[model samples]
Target: MVKLIALYRHPEDQESFDKHYEQVHTPLVEKMPGLKKLEVTRIQGAPMGGEAKYYLEAAMYFADRAALDAAMSSPEGKASAKDLMGFAGSLVTMMIGEVSREG
Candidate 1:
């Protein structure tokens, strides 16, 4: 399996970001051809009880790397990417990796 991990930093306006993410961005992500699952988490604090480095995390799961690549080149994927860059380009960091082991 392969996945794209997105780590979002604290936005200038949390309410607006949350609203747009839930209403708009999420739907766009759901349209991708090879998307198996989308898991999102809101980061609250570090283990030591202070602020965490990231505000949120999103994991987009795919069947494999080829599926991931195909999804990235799809029209739906292009739209989603545009939306992401329009809204959170500066505040988000994304990475792609394979799952070596999972339960």
Candidate 2:
């Protein structure tokens, strides 16, 4: 499976960011092709220094790298990606990567 990890920093106004995400970003990402599952989480606590490093995070799961790649190549993906700019101030870091295991 492959997952796109989107780490959003604390928004200038967190309330607005949460509202907008539910009203806009979530729906937009949900409509993208090859989206197996979509999860949004609020970051809390410290992964390492007893302090939280991020404000929000999202995990978009895909069937595999090919599906994820195809999604990124599609019109919806392209548009949704561009829409990310709308939340520029609320974004800290975003990354997409793959994971697999041998048995």
- Candidate whose lDDT is highest: 1
Candidate 1: stretches off by over 4 Å: none
Colliding pairs, model 2: none
Candidate 2, residue 50: CA error in Å?
A: 5.3
Residue lDDT tens for model 1, 1-103: 9999999999999999999999999999999998999999999899999999999999999999999999999999999999999999999999998999988
The lDDT per prediction is 0.97, 0.81
* Top TM-score model: 1
The whole-model C-alpha lDDT of candidate 1 against the native structure comes to: 0.97
As for model 2, its CA RMSD to the true structure in angstroms is 2.6
Off by over 4 Å in 2: 47-51, 101-103
Q: Which ten residues in a row have the lowest lDDT in candidate 2?
A: 85-94
